[model samples]
Target: DMTQAASTGGMMEMPRASRGQAHLKLAEFAAKQLRGETRVASFSLNGWDTHSRQKRNLGAALERLSGCILALKQGVGPAVWDKTAVVAMTEFGRTVRENGTGGTDHGTGGTMVLAGGAIRGGRVYGRWPGLEEATLYNRRDLMPTGDVREVCAWIMRGITGTGISDLETKVFPGMQMAQDPGFLR
Candidate 1:
């Protein structure tokens, strides 16, 4: 998938096995960490900035992201997977509409994906602010309907049984979290 984008710089080119190798590698590493010594693991994937040619750019990025997620699920195996909760988040959102170059610009109200057997899948969570022009953040990007920190806090609470008091003050200072969205199963 990434081979196409990488070899030709967003065009179909020769197949390259080495293209986007980090996805599966990191996934395998995450799985090993979970199986061995680590309880919480974090890794990152880049190239999400689509300032131009968004379709081609995002296609490869999303493909790699998908592969990484799949690799993580497979590598962790069912036993560990059942208890695992994986999250992938970006720092900010993209513009609501394609720009002059058919790409997106940086803005606010981004998203994160949460996965694991313990998660409540098959649905989109959080309140949506809608695509109407009036609702966009700065009238350009997606307006956040809820606090992202709350989502993370709730996930932490669901996994570690940490209390709201500490989560608000210690883990995430000055956060006033909402009631659980029931992401855990």
Candidate 2:
């Protein structure tokens, strides 16, 4: 469901209808490319940085993201969905409190979303570091409980059938990769 559009300088815009259509077209393209070949693929999206008046910006971004996800589910059908894995993430999170500009400042920690039938669906993964005054990092951001690399290693071994030896020493060095202790199973 990854789609590209003509960039309007730094302000690219695509109508919702067009975006949906692009999703369908891209799905068709992917299916054709993957015909009689591999079952695994990775995709990414960008432009999530919001520093001012983020409510609408965030909602719109998430809406488009969700739409792409649903489109993929429909595009691949049930069998593919059973083996598919979708992981979405941001490089960093922002301050818990809105800034003077109605957005947030750069801060540590954010969230990642995993989708697909291979994943344990309808469940929120990760430990919740409470937003209490002292719990916040630098008194402004959420604390990260899980090392993201551990999550990746777990995914590799459990989902892709990568050997533990490969995952630890070859794929992720100095990671001491452990079994996924979360809901990915």
Model 1, residue pairs in steric clash: none
Local accuracy of candidate 1 as per-residue lDDT tens digits, 90-143: 888899899999999897888888888879898998778799999887889899
RMSD of candidate 1 to true structure, Å: 8.4
TM-scores, one per candidate: 0.87, 0.78
Those runs of model 1 whose alpha carbons end farther than 4 Å from true positions after fitting are 1-19
Clashes of each: 0, 0
Best by lDDT: 1
Please state the error at residue 4 of candidate 1 in Å: 31
How far out, in Å, is residue 83 in model 2? 1.0
**lDDT over C-alpha atoms for residue 134 of model 2:** 96
The TM-score leader among the candidates is: 1
User: Candidate 1 has what TM-score?
Assistant: 0.87
lDDT by residue (tens digit), candidate 2, 6-104: 221222232343643554445444433333244554445544777887886788678767877777777677877787777777778888988887888
Among all windows of 10 consecutive residues in model 1, the one with the lowest summed lDDT is 1-10
